[model samples]
Target: MDTSGFLEWLKASLSSSEKTSDRRILRFVHPDDDKRFLRSLRAERPGSKPLRGIRRLGIIRAYSCPVPPEGLPVSFGGAIVWEEDIRVSTHAILAAQRVPADSGIPWGVRRIRAPEAWSRTTGHRVRVGVIDTGVDFDHPDLRHSLERGINLLQRTALPHDDNGHGTHIAGTIAAANRMQGMIGVAPRSAIYPIKAFDYNGTAYVSDIILGIDWCVRNRMDVVNMSFGMSTRSKSLLNAVSNAYRSGVLIVASSGNDGKRGRIDYPAKYPQTVAVGAINRKGEIASFTNRSDSVDIYAPGERVDSCWLRGNRKTMSGTSMATSHVTGAVALLLAHKPGLTPEQVKTVLKRSKRPLRNAKAPRKTGELDIARMLQVADKLM
Candidate 1:
């Protein structure tokens, strides 16, 4: 939108108070008003004038909405979504690769590739929702970074990490351990655990939709979905679509069935970035499912991290890989303020760690951290 026209629209909205009588148009606003946009809510009714600073910028060509911006995707094709600001929190992206182990509950911090950039920034205040098996609040790797959570599956008052999958996924993306263990992709990031699966690895589509709806309503910068299914659900896709329109990033596992191109529900739905499994050796795990929807690969086979029952163990599947990408997306959100879910996907794909061969059996490449932070805005 033109600068003059945008200003004019804001002035008119403040006076009339409506974007349109029937719709809430969500798109990017200028830097000066982004913060205010988040803190302030539009009071105008559907048919009122419009909200101030809200512009009909049309489709943001800079970022791919995964699915197109008009309405929702045909088969979860795409949705119109936009992000407000960058949440740069340097404390959130630290890792634990080389840290020394503790005697009993010790965990080391894995150093991120670009410490210099983070050194100059405190990191963004990015809040990512972890929709998985639930997380343990006491895990050494995830203690301080833990924030709020919900249990959509059990409908409990508090959502705890029971299945261990959510905790590992949480640790990978936002665990903030300054003295020990590993730091996540966005170490300083806050985690909102929304448990949708039980310890038995079962969940209902209704619960998953609730989880996605919560993330969207709560304004989560990214949602870590470590589960997938073969059958498609209207509720699931609609929830995802609602989230996209609300500017929530959906990252899901590519499924662990290990079958060649076994179709997964939400992951296969074009609305999400489906992550595949990769071993420490950078090889795709044999059990990892392959599909045209697989967006990227990450450490999955026996990938070591926090586990269920307060245990630290190795687990496999695209579930682990999704956490890696989730963490990475959190980092980008922290530094690249104002990135749409689509733009974040764009940068990550561009920065991907190339596979050994483009024509190899596993075309998807490994996680690329260095290239991701190359264009981040300094938080400090």
Candidate 2:
């Protein structure tokens, strides 16, 4: 049987006495065939039912199962791949990577030339889904654009923010550019916060996958992932593929591990745009992970944006950088709702401004939101 079928069987028969060492998630080539697959699994293996079903995405129905001492079968009767579930952490390194900000409008805002782009579109018709902890809807800057959110942590439909990280990310992407405080890249865009992480800023692979599934089912135009994990998960690949194939542009943080290692998984995945961090001087931050998968760089060091309690805070991480691209993409999509993930990527990559970064060669360039908008306008 395939890994999905095997896992479905394993989840049903699991007991304290079973000493299985496998930790695998399985996916079917045709996600729409889930019902048929499940029925076949039941017929082939008696007394088995999956613990639960994740069906909203229409690309995967993952099940967790143990690995027998011997090993996973080379192949199931049907097509399937065994995948591992890896924990994904908020990419923020806290104050450790924070750099001193020079006196001026937030460098990130000025660097991308967001004010000029605003004249064209504030992402009015675009819908963005943030897959993070949650957003603080009470924050004045974020209150209007933030719609109802799903708290995957508690499995509730509540607008909540436990770790404050998600709120910060949301503010970067859609905080209404009110005169009083910090503004976002796409101020008028709609934000859907999917709380996948908990108070500790840690989430299981399952949580992130479910969040992506939700985004796909809801028809999100853009999905922002400000987190990273080193290991790759087949389940995640399937989810991302589903979203991309369905016309959602997924953006993720390249990671904060610096020269120590490669870009983190999900970001490293081809379907998502991997963004790195840049300092105020338009140079890559030493902490931003340098890897071939990094598709672009954005202002992330000491970047000022909205925080919890209707406050503004300065944070530094590839996570913050990712929201810049997320909002930028939103603006593009708002101007042209039919922009495919590939077309949006081409415009952003082609319109990037040249930058001098000795340490990170993958830092394609800094975001030029205005130019991107102009190109998108012409294309549309």
Q: Which candidate is the best by TM-score?
A: 2
Off by over 4 Å in 1: 1-117, 120-123, 154-156, 357-363, 375-380
Error of 2 at 91 (Å): 0.7
Please give each candidate's TM-score. 0.67, 0.84
Encode model 1's per-residue lDDT on 10-54: one tens digit a residue: 445446433232222233335434333333333332344434323
| RMSD in order of candidates | 13.1, 4.4
Candidate 2 weakest lDDT stretch, 10 residues: 95-104
Cα-based lDDT for every prediction: 0.60, 0.77
Q: Estimate, for each residue in 332-363, the C-alpha lDDT of model 2 and write its tens digit.
A: 88888798999988888888887775654544
How far off is residue 39 in model 1, in Å?
A: 31
Per candidate, the number of residue pairs that clash is 38, 2
What would the TM-score be for candidate 1 when compared with the true structure?
Answer: 0.67
lDDT of 1 at 186: 66
lDDT of 2 at 220: 91
